[model samples]
Target: EAGVAQSPRYKIIEKRQSVAFWCNPISGHATLYWYQQILGQGPKLLIQFQNNGVVDDSQLPKDRFSAERLKGVDSTLKIQPAKLEDSAVYLCASSSTGQWNNSPLHFGNGTRLTVT
Candidate 1:
């Protein structure tokens, strides 16, 4: 089976600019997620999706970040007016079951973004 795929493995932009990241989750997975990892910190869940509908986004910075899963397969995450503090690795992950289940998450290598 194919793993989650991400593009533009790395990106660099000045503060106040905008950037976008792309992800393609494994097939047949019903749950997908986005996580942000700042250097020296653990990855933090930013949003979760179940079959093209948003399931959780409590940790997402709504004013600066947005994400969408289209038709339950491909997903995109965008940041507007990037902040130096936003420099981090953005990871995409997927599981076969919903949040309540114990299905292990499979993650993409991630897109590393650096805001200068």
Candidate 2:
């Protein structure tokens, strides 16, 4: 019954440097999600994956942001040449299939990225 795991907790980077964050979701969960939470705002879904295939990525910024859930397990989110607005908490969550509407997502505290 392991919960979601994230790394670095915090990061500070220049506006043009690239940064990456990692996440390991709960065991036996079939759906994984990545969210960006800016200060004072609710989490916004960046991408979602059902197993190895992407279920939704409509909100992801394609120009300089990318993500993947390799092997249908651990996932990574990368921001290349970061921007000042990219500073936010990157949260990961997972839920068992068929319980999407009933079960709440288990979220990692998140990796707080700061662009200076």
Candidate 3:
């Protein structure tokens, strides 16, 4: 399967600035997920969506971050008033089904954000 499409592979911004990243999941994928991977640590699931509805967003920083999947095909993640600690690789992954553990995740190259 082809990889999920993600844009703006790298970004540099000052602290408290806002930035956004876009993603297009693979065709026929019913589940989409966003993750934040800090250096030297495993990727942390930020949000999960089954089609256009959100399945889970417990780990997402709602005060500074937001994401949406419109019509179930594409999605976007945005961070407003970003903090220095928010610097990390933002990953977009898709799976054949909503059952995350049951389906293999096809991940994009990811957008690396740098907060100065």
Candidate 4:
């Protein structure tokens, strides 16, 4: 029984540069999510995917941020023309079911992004 996995635990780039992060959810998990956590602030849901279809992305910044859960197993998140405000920790989480309220989401350690 393994947990969620994320790569490039830390990243640093100049403002306006592009960055991408990867996530591999637990096996059999049907729900995946990406979140952003600014220092001193709780994580904010950026996107939610059930299998390969998007369930929610209302908070995602469409102008610069994009994410996808391909094949309903792995996911990737990218930020283009990254802004200084985008400096934060990006979290990847997943649940075995779509019952968000009833199922618990397991999270990876997260990728810390720094924009200089």
Residue-wise C-alpha lDDT for candidate 2, range 50-87, written one tens digit per residue: 88888889999989999998899899999998999999
87 Cα displacement, candidate 3 (Å): 0.6
Q: Name the lDDT value of residue 65 in candidate 4.
A: 95
- For all predicted structures, in order, the TM-scores are 0.97, 0.94, 0.96, 0.97
In model 2, the runs with Cα more than 4 Å from the true position are: 98-102
Model 2 TM-score, 2 decimals: 0.94
Candidate 4: what lDDT?
0.95
Q: Clashing residue pairs in candidate 2, if any? A: none
Candidate 2: residue 92 lDDT (0-100): 95
Scored by CA lDDT, what does every candidate get?
0.95, 0.91, 0.95, 0.95
Off by over 4 Å in 4: 99-101
Q: Report backbone clashes per prediction.
A: 0, 0, 0, 0
- Candidate 3 residues lying further than 4 Å off, grouped into runs, are none
* Candidate number with the higher TM-score (3 or 4): 4
RMSD of each: 0.7, 1.4, 1.1, 0.9
Query: Cα deviation in Å at residue 5, candidate 4?
Result: 0.2
- Candidate 1: tens digits of C-alpha lDDT, residues 9-116: 999999999999999999999999999999999999999999999999999999999999878889999999899999999999999998789999999999999999
